[model samples]
Target: MPTNVSNLPPVRRWVPAPVTKEDIDWADLTFVDLAKAKTPEGRAEQVRLARDATHRQGFFYVINHGLDKAIVDRMIDIAALAFDDVSEEEKIRYRARIKETGEYLGYKLPQYWHIANGVKDRIEHYNFPRDVSRREHPNVLRPFLPEVQRIVEFTHRGVLNEVQKLLSLGLELPENTLPDLHPFDETNHSFWRFMLYNPRSQEEEDKTDNVWMKGHADHTSFTAIWSQPVTALQIKDWDGQWRYVRHVENALVVNCGDTTEYLSGGYYKSAVHRVIKPPSDQDGYRRLGLYYFHYMADDVRIAPLLDSPVVQREGVNKFIVGVPPVQETWRKNRASTYGVTQLERAEDGTEYEVVNGVRVTHYN
Candidate 1:
């Protein structure tokens, strides 16, 4: 008989779950309530939880964070309708044109990304940039799930702001420390993504290893994912073991990214995670996900937090330095990672590759 997850211990809170390796213990991920974070004590406690989670696990579930079930459900419904209802030709009408020019602020059809194992990721997605200026782009103005775009845009900004507050609190810096870098101005580099992963047949699932997405980190400062009832999402624990991440009703999953890890001088970590085939029942149906990638403005420089005590003790030598602006990094990273060949080389000819597009590397 297959395992029934619902009968297990509290799925919302941290509880014991069997792991693949005998030496690996189940991770103790926390669920922080943002509503209570209104008070100083509540905020402090939440910050403590966040601090510990980032330092150790780099991912956690959040509750009472302002996004309601209606919003999440509507987003999901709209995403499904867009991908399932809209004809492929219609979607292609808005298909990303800027990728050729080294921009990723539009629609991407399935199979645009390939796994290291030569398997193409079966996903279709539409990306919306937070920068108001990009609103005039043909892809943005084109009618490909307009309502879905609106709701996601509204929800993502609010969530990023709140998460930034929590991050600042956890870092022991002024609440605006991170927010100051991420403004919703015309130069915004943030983006919201609506994604649908096509389902696999039982025969296909059985023959495959089921690693639909390779483990990687987000390149932005923060990433927020709405919880869906799928069991494919897995995160690497401190012990280097991969375990399924549980979905709690009405909770959003948040994870740190490479930019944040750099900013914090390694005090916080960027999680390594991936998606595989879910359990038997879910494997038969399409999986939909909503994601928000938060970033500083194009002009904001990437640098370590000089005032952070954590950085002071750890020493700046261990952290990244002299990084370019956010947009520069974003363009170069996206182009290199996705094989968008247009802007692969800088004018001066430094060879760079975006390892997973979230991590950066350069070679002479």
Candidate 2:
């Protein structure tokens, strides 16, 4: 049974992933099994694997991280309930003040952003920053905050921290090198999000070519997406071709984000990903996503770790002076993502906006 069972609404039919299509070529992403890191040899091997995953694909799957299955199911169930049980009129009361404050700590309606040709995104989500209690939620999710918090805490400590350390070791830096910059005790934009991608009509789907979200990188550091069976998630491969991320029960599809590119001096590039409509076997089902976004401390400098042997050898690719702090970058990028301010598109056909000398990309 999931957590907060007594308070949960009647369980809805949980949709599972369909049989993976045989003709589709899935990305051969590296797998980092957390349970394998119990021994020194095991940890060393994981470090190599982590480096490979970061260096090339920039996205990988993590398994055996010890997050209980029931807890994950509870979070998923609560996501569906939070979005469906609340009325649109009432949901706005708790919406994030993105245009005003650039903080992503509440519900977001799908009708806010224009995807392409004025077709708004077909997704709704609730963001719970590390200090989730800062924002008010609807009654449907009020009782499940603690359960959701568990997901955030575990993802931060049990997952992100370990992965950070492993990557730092791969850089030949101290084990705590990267993790120290992202202290959970302090506040940052790191958030746990419950996302629901609503199904689109055939006309709308055809108009947009079935892309739910556009192909772009994340603005934060690391993102851990709890893998559901849905086959809509895809990542741009090394050859710049999009490939579906294979589904693994109870695994997390973790990826690097932009801030990490600056911190590691470009040793790790941010993963570019997008969501599209599911295959024929899984079409018309609402896609549920649980994500933990990790960001560095706001006061931390967004520069290369020169102490890293790999970085020193490779040289810093993004060591510009007068770089803005993490807060401004996070806020500006967050605020501009949906064009809270004026937005522009490049002649080259990519949606782009600049903030603090950074080019933020969006889908058309």
Candidate closest to the true structure, highest lDDT: 2
Off by over 4 Å in 2: 1-13, 319-321, 339-348
How does candidate 2 fare on TM-score?
Answer: 0.92
TM-score between candidate 1 and the true structure: 0.79
The residue pairs that clash in candidate 1, if any, are: none
Model 2 RMSD in Å is 2.5
Give each model's whole-structure lDDT.
0.66, 0.81
TM-score of each: 0.79, 0.92
- Clash number by candidate, in order: 0, 0
lDDT of 1 at 51: 83
Residue-level error in angstroms, candidate 1, position 337 = 1.7
lDDT of 1 by residue, 190-219 (tens): 777778778755454444467677666667
Q: Which ten residues in a row have the lowest lDDT in candidate 2?
A: 1-10
Per-residue lDDT tens digits for candidate 2, residues 190-238, read: 8888898999988888778888887878878889999887788899998
